[model samples]
Target: MKTTVEQSLRAYLDDKTANGELGPGSRLPTERALVAQLDAPRSAVRRALDTLEGEGVVTRHVGRGTFLTESARAGAEAAPPDTSPVEIMQVRLVIEPPVAMLAARLATQADLDRIVECLQAGGASSTFEDFEAWDAKLHRAIAHAAHNGLLLSMFDVMNTARTLPVWGTLKRRTSTPERRGCYHQEHEAIVGALVDRDPEKAERTMRVHLEHVADNLLGRV
Candidate 1:
């Protein structure tokens, strides 16, 4: 299991990479820099980097600084298979409740802050495109809060699948203002459970939210 500091560092890296701040073969900041920036212990920083290197996300050299692996960058941009909305929902139902449960158990103050930011931004969105973008951000924030590297990686892949044209077309066809309002409430419930650190409630709320989404997207539970 990762310590809180290690998890925080991983989430930081994930966010940086996603936003194109750190790209293929980009050198990571120095250990001293990371420690100061993350307010993390040097040892914890080293450990996090070690774990990431072991996972093939980075490379280290004796005199050179760490660099993101080319493969890691490629993997993030790779296209997923053409999966149906029902199939994606099935996978989400199986994976995300547990993810939310973990987030409730593990999310730190910073994680909670990011999740709430996404939630508020999504709720305030005026267009379906904006709302959908924030919706993806909110889910990604929750996944990061889970602080399980492998699970986060899997969620990233599943999220990529959602970018397919078919998924967007279906969502556009099915979207209604009422449904979006319902989704906002559901998001609030999920975040509330996380803030309360109620793992069981978090899991239940996440399952409920996904079931509603599946019903909207697939026209059946």
Candidate 2:
């Protein structure tokens, strides 16, 4: 029921009616004509018209086309939303590595304090969910040091799109001291690079760290 065709047609019709091009009791163009005008399918045009008629915004006769009812424009503006997840990751691929670099280049002793806390918490957390929460905090700490509001805003949105459901499986499969120790050691290396204020080294180290995760995700390792 939530067709792009319907949503676009609704907006087009609403705008025309608001500008007095379509008034109450006005018969819209024939369904076939509308399909051509909107570049939508015949089924889409019929569905939009059916919805309009059902809402009393338009009436249909056996031979005549749909007409605009008194309240035709009121409810047409409310349509369901369709958002894409890829749209979010595209932004992350632009922003996060640079944020890690910036945090190393610009972070003061005070700024490093917070990042150190988050890193420590992440390394120590026993539960996968708890570790993930602290890990997110560690990344957010780097974003906070970027000193650019737009980049930070973009980082927040990207963080919301990261959906890795395999962590629980890995947690159970690798439930041993050595596997957990490797994770902690890798994180410590990243934090150590950041603490040394070497942007290039930190960025490369973080990328290598994430590449390990990428390998696991793709089943390449």
Candidate 3:
């Protein structure tokens, strides 16, 4: 039987994933950080992580940190086949603006903290790969903040589709420093609206951001 601390740790991790502080292939916080954050003994944290590793929810590298397993990130269903980048963008525009609005209305302090963390990380990223990873994380974080499990699952499926090779190719082909800076600023605006708890503004800003992304990717000025 699991100890109470172990159960609590599992629940904590579940919450973290649901709120986008952790995701598929994302590193877990350091054991020291977890200890401090959870106010639990280091031993218990280690044991909890060990249990998760054994269950295949996470994997630990000798020199690197623990990361969520890709299999663990799958939603209730698999992504549909052969989704083009343009189609993905279209679907995102339809789904995400409402997600942002709901996030604005419902986000907890912890959710907001993680969203801001992703934003800062994306802004600080030097490489397009790093920026894109954080960009996805930021959007997923916002989706999770909506606190609707079905919407989150759908968002996760959409996000999985984004990992398709064609999507990456298009994103790489279109990437530019100026465009990246503009995206960061747009991200700030969306986050700012969420922080202010303005649902309408959050929805509008999210739509505008996605529209800009669609235009950029489709080569429409």
Candidate 4:
């Protein structure tokens, strides 16, 4: 059975995830912070962190801060042999809109900075591979700003699926410079909404963006 301190700490983290306060790869508060915030003993905080480490939900470095782990992400991205690119997009459609909404509600300045960096990089990319990489980074940054580990892990899976040869083939055929420019505009719109902290706008923009991408892939819009 878990101690009260451990249980309380877990509940706190869960609540943070729900509220977008603790995104994937984001560092956890220091033991001093945890002790103060949770009103628990230092030993209790240490033990709770230790328990999370054992569960693979977090990792601790000697000097660096504790961080959410990629264990779940690795498992989520283990694509099945028969998985299709369309299926991956289907999953993305289901997950990404909500992530945008949460990010709009909770993104910090740091998160926005990282996202903007990716956006700039994407725009400056001279090659398809480079653009796609920055695109992935931008999307991942948004998901991270959502502060939901599970959702980010799910995104990792879908993102990995996009790297499949089939996806590469299809995108290569359809991704004209014109289309890439359109995607950049859509990404800008989504980021604008996030910066405004407008959850409804963020959610709607993200949905429309994904829909456009899907239609493009299917040669519909």
The C-alpha local distance difference test score for the whole of candidate 3 amounts to 0.82
- What TM-score does structure 1 among the candidates reach? 0.68
Ranking by TM-score: 3, 1, 4, 2
* Best by the lDDT measure: 3
C-alpha TM-scores of all predictions: 0.68, 0.52, 0.69, 0.67
lDDT of each: 0.81, 0.63, 0.82, 0.78
Error of model 4, residue 108, in angstroms: 1.0
Candidate 4, TM-score vs. the true structure?
0.67
Evaluated at residue 143, the lDDT of candidate 2 is 72
Per-residue alpha-carbon lDDT of model 3 for 74-130, expressed as tens digits? 631365658888788888988999999999999999989989988998899888866
Q: Is candidate 3 or candidate 4 better by lDDT?
A: 3
- Model 4 stretches astray by more than 4 angstroms: 1-69, 219-221
- Candidate 1, residues 100-179, lDDT tens digits: the string is 99999999999999899889988998878667867877887798899888887777667656756698799999998889
Question: Which run of 10 residues does model 3 get worst, by summed lDDT?
Answer: 50-59
Residue 160 CA error for candidate 1 (Å)?
A: 0.2
**Better candidate by lDDT, 2 or 3:** 3
